[model samples]
Target: MTTLPAVSQHNPWTTLGAEVRYENNWIRVVENDVINPAGNPGIYGVVHFKGVAIGVLPIDAEGCVHLVGQYRYSLEAYSWEMPEGGGSPSVSPVEEAKRELREETGLLARQWRELLRIHTSNSICDEHGVIYIAWDMDQTESEPEDTEDLIIIRMPFARVVDLVLDGAITDAMTVAAVLKAQLLAERGQLPEDVAKLMLGR
Candidate 1:
């Protein structure tokens, strides 16, 4: 008989106490007093997000991508990014993605494929984000939220990739989606028709 080594999955940090520093409709701030993984006493602050973040990269049959530009209040700078918003926890992610696409760019995609899922920032918050690639699109009048004043631009998908690589696009979700979609197109990992459009073939 051979003995095998035990692989244990266990939590390392010991939570001695926790306090809610602040909370709002979108997030909650929690301060935790804990013993660290290194066994040192310390405190950790966490921002708990209320909904899933959704991002959509809408590519049309003409090998063009739609981008949205807005002045981010938090960053205090202008940013160009894929259509994105927070999805209500009660709704399906794809449904949310569809709604965000239509609201932000006024385009409805007949075909939808999920491209990536990631943690936006794990160190401070547990914000989960999902990105989708949309194609076979129909354009209509946009209905942006009252809180948003946006600018929409349509350009070649390749140009969008260049913007990301050239240090223009910084939104985490947009960056991840564009890079992943590019990789998929290059590796033949996407649907033949969609990949052709994305790669401008």
Candidate 2:
């Protein structure tokens, strides 16, 4: 009988204590006192999110997608992305995605599929998010929040994927969703109609 080496699955960092360094309604920053994976003393600061992030990519029957444009406060730059919003822990992510899509693009989708889950900045923050694909859409008046000054544009799905590849779309969720959508369409993994629309087949 041959003996195999045992692979350890235990966490290497040992947390001795934690303290909240800052907090707000949206996030809490905690500084942790810990012994490092290399057995050295160190501290780690983590930003804990108070809610989940939700994003929706709505594809119309004409093979176009709606993108929302706005200036991001943190980035101090304008961004073009799919409909996105924060989701409360008490609410369903799908429901939240629907609300965001409606508020940002005024489109209601009869069909929705979860596309992906992501952590925006895993090295520093615990901001988890859900991305969705919504089709069979109906247009309505957008109900953007008072704080939102939004611009909506409709473009071919393939063009949007090109924008992502060309570095024009930098929003993490939007980039991930669009690329995933493109791959799905190429692989014939999406619904036949939707895939056809995406690939212009």
Candidate 3:
């Protein structure tokens, strides 16, 4: 298992605060103040995040995985990624996953399994992303949010691994989720018992 290095050793900086300089629906920039490990105080910089969420290898009735291609303003282009979101104050992570899946791909799963909790960027942000595995999915009409413009693509389960190896899919959380699901499936532990419990089956 790969673990992030301790903050104290990874960066020679301790944050004091990030004053918001600008804010918008898509992004926000902040000016930060920090004290370097060498005991030198100086002005630093970082983005204040509103957080994000990601779903793992989703398995459909035909044993296919669903992926989405959407434009990422930060990246300045479209990229293939799993269904994800920033989560709503009114919904739990699980609910958010379901919503994102339907919104982005017009799919709904009968079962959902949590894969892991990952920090998208731990160095200077408060963003924590939760990964989940969705299976037994059924297709439905998409209900994308007003801000979303996504295209859905379904690929063979085997092809997902190939995409990762070929560098076609580069989103860290998506990669982690797919790898984790593969690991679990190989060990005969896929769709963990807890997930069955969630589905009341």
Candidate 4:
């Protein structure tokens, strides 16, 4: 059985004070003095995101999924995963997904569907991530942002699943979306055309 959220909500933690520790174009960090749920006084630092994160898993007609590789500043390493970016909270998540897909791979998907909604690091950050599956695309030249240096690759969707299982792809959104897509295929939950395309490869 599943338990859903109640219509009424209550907050347990009480904040004594809050101060901004840092701010950037994308995120803001705040230090909050609070009384814990257990009645202890402590400080909690939180990273607040300014925009919603968007991720797109674009699979072509031949069952090839597009991946983007780039150097991650925070990790100081190169990561390969689904094409993803951030979108203004004012815009629809699906619209941002389309933009990210187009910017990273220059592919416009004819069909799009959401895959998952997640919070990347809820304990220390308030960042919302939305993952999507896109198919039946038209390919063209990529127009990456000036700050982005990306490498695009097209490979079998199954290979992406292998990478996920092998821990080679650790991006939260990518991991979730790829596994979800596989599960959907296994359970015959996807569209007849999309499922056949994914399972076929």
**Per-model TM against the reference:** 0.95, 0.95, 0.80, 0.94
User: Candidate 4 regions off by >4 Å?
Assistant: 4-9
Clashing pairs in 1: none
lDDT of 1 by residue, 1-201 (tens): 599998877989999999999999999999999999999999999999999999999999898999999999999999999999999989999999999999999999999999999999999999999889999999998999998999999999999999999988999999999999999899999999999998878
lDDT of candidate 2 at residue 56, scale 0 to 100: 94
Judge candidate 4 against the unseen true structure and give its global Cα lDDT, from 0 to 1.
0.92
Query: C-alpha displacement of 176 in model 2, angstroms?
Result: 0.7
Off by over 4 Å in 2: 1-8
Q: In model 1, what is the error at residue 14, expressed in angstroms?
A: 0.7
How far does residue 15 in candidate 2 sit from its true spot (Å)? Answer: 0.9
Q: Relative to the unseen true structure, what is the C-alpha lDDT of residue 28 in candidate 1, on a scale of 0 to 100?
A: 98
- Badly placed stretches (over 4 Å) of model 1 are 1-8
Error of 3 at 36 (Å): 0.9
Query: For candidate 1, what is the total of clashing residue pairs?
Result: 0
lDDT of each: 0.94, 0.94, 0.75, 0.92
What is the descending TM-score order? 1, 2, 4, 3
Q: Give per-model CA RMSD.
A: 4.0, 3.8, 4.8, 1.9
* Tens digit per residue, CA lDDT, model 3, 1-201: 799866654765789887988888745777888898899888865666654655655777666778888888878977888887777545688888888788778887888778899987776666678888888778899888888888888887668877987998888888887777766666668655533322223
